[model samples]
Target: MSVFQSINPYSQALIQEYPLMDTGKINAALETAANGYHIWRRMRFAERAGVLLNAAKILRAGKEKYAQLITIEMGKVLPESLGEVEKCAWVCEYYAEHGETFLADEQIIAGYQKSFVTYEPIGAVLAIMPWNFPFWQVFRYAAPTLMAGNVTLLKHAPNVSGCSLAIAEIFKAAGAPEGVFQSIIIDVDAVEKILSTPIVQAVTLTGSERAGTSVAAIAGRHVKKSLLELGGSDALIVLPDADLQKAATVALQSRLLNAGQSCIGSKRFIVVKAVLDDFMQLLLNGISQYRQGDPMETGITTGPLARPDLAANLSAQLTGSIKSGAKLEYGGRFDGCNVMPSLLMNVQPGMAAFDQETFGPLAAVVAANDEQHAIELANLSPYGLGGSVWTKDIDKGISLARQITTGAVFINSLVKSDPRLPFGGVKKSGYGRELGRHGILEFVNAKTIAAEL
Candidate 1:
């Protein structure tokens, strides 16, 4: 059978290799999950919560080991990798405490004497996740779905196969029964075969628009529910009256974090003409502070892109944007995956930087005539994922935020996913929500019952 190798993006070291599972192994896993779901679904909420709580403890105790693995495999800075592990633990704790209540039955006043809507588990859910923030993405989907009594089968990115197996082991050590949570090492054809199986009930994907579309089409063909969290070119709007220094600081942090691999990372900086120059200057000053090196080493503020291809793609986009009239302000050079954080000024609607999602440490600045023009520019992208509006006036911020068509919009702050809030996007950015009450309910069947008293 074929094998998948996990390599360190920074050092170019081979971390581990995984052999692909064949048809027999795949069938066995599906059968086990189908059997395990029956038992898991019947368990009490407190019992399920116990398993998740134990998983949280395991994650916390092994944070350093897991964090190091993330850094080695995905090229995230060591500190950020540690933070991702901590966040994964937090998600587990959040669901363990609130999942039952989030999925609790809702009483309704109907014609019958007693009527209510109950949320029940939908069998096995297939989570197809990306490599960027690998641990966080998996836990965010697993924590709630498992708590809601649904089994999970993860098809993680091939480059992070070691991480995928590590997570599965964590759940196993935390007292999860076999097959309740399994990371299957399989190919794309195998994924299609699994999705076609009757045992796999639903699907959730966090990847590029192309991958999302392909998975969604297969899920649709089988009549299985699908939740997609896809690509984004989110706008970071800076109003004239906003705090320039704070905006610049947050903007740089949001864009450069994970070396700008985040789907919700601010791709377009829409600034009002009045304070554009000040914001640009402060942004440049902030960019100068970042230092890129080995992700495992200390004192490195930024790490390389996850792979060489990602860096090359970002380079092409930067070159095309510059050719399309956008000016390269600073730092456009890259050594393999180790890209220097770059900035592009005079970015307009037609330029690659402004029009496409740049999944690297490249920032694009677009000038807006006024507040209305800023909102218009923000909504111009085909993507409607997360966005941010920077303004001191809460009322104006809220009003302008409402005008921008996206999933989640933050005022005076950067956009991010929180366990307490629902997260997803609109239009080509994909559909359905994750996290909070909505997320817990995504894989559950909301059954309405009516009976006479």
Candidate 2:
């Protein structure tokens, strides 16, 4: 058995090492989750909701410790990691408060016939999450899935093994049954075997493009449900009449949040010619002011990439962008695992950074001739996860936003994952949502019941 070491991205200190699970433990967890689902799905809506609500309280009471583990494992700033924990709690409570109503039986009129749709659990759901927001990503899926009467089996990033077990413990403390949600310490190679099991009915992944494809293929082979939130080259569109100052500020935050490791983070900035200069200036100024050092420090706005390889890949992407005619405006160098926030200009369509998802502290600026060009450039990529269309004019911004071929678009705002609204993307960004009513319903079997008149 191989024991993988977890390190703090910021301090470059080894946190701990865990022996990878063998076949026996993986099979046991799968069996447990499958068996637990039978009784879990039979529970009353209110009863299930109570488990999730209690989990919310458990999270809130221990937010500081959970946040520390998250920061130590992945280099998320303490404040931001705390915010992630707080958000996790919110997701838990949200489902607990509204799940019953959301999943209630729905009546429908089919001409002369009457029909109703009843939501039912789909047994054990396998959640494969990333390290960027370790706790948040796992809970975002777990809260709703558990509340929906389905059991969850987590396969988290090995680097964040402690956080993974911590999450499962919290749920257990909140009155979740023995197998309601289990954290499996298995490698990617082990996923297919678990997926092949009889009890695992669905899987949801928040991970890299490669991981998404691998999991999706396995899930497809088994004819199971899959929700994939894959890589994104999300565009931040700034129009002529846009508030340059606000746009630049939001753009900086959107690209830099989670140390620039988010799926929906803005990797490309599409600016209309009229405001290109102003937007570029503001972007440079904003990037310069970001505080970077130890993430454990109270004021640091940025942290190292989750690992050294990620930083190296970021360097390669920046180098490739420069080679492709994109001008490196600021912060193009990488030291160890810390890559400073970067801004690239003169980005053309064919450049790797312009079209591909740059999962680091790099942003490519593509100047557009007009609104049509901006929209066209934004849609040029094969990935269409989410984007923001910035303009002061509400009607015009909303109209242009509607035209963007992304899962979600914001007008005069930044792209975000909200539990209240539907989220996911089109094209190669992968299918299925991770938030809102759509997310809760994603893992359920939507059955239609009919009664003869």
lDDT against the true structure, per candidate, is 0.93, 0.88
RMSD of each: 0.8, 1.3
lDDT of 1 at 360: 94
Candidate 2, superposed: residue stretches over 4 Å from native: 111-114
TM-scores for all predictions: 0.99, 0.98
Model 2 lDDT-worst window of ten: 1-10
Kindly list the per-residue Cα lDDT of model 1 for residues 313-391, writing each as its tens digit: 9999999998889999999989988999999999999888988899999999999999999999999998999999999
**lDDT, residue 297, candidate 2:** 86
Best candidate (score: TM-score) = 1
Worst 10 residues of 1 by lDDT: 187-196
Q: Name model 1 segments beyond 4 Å from true.
A: none
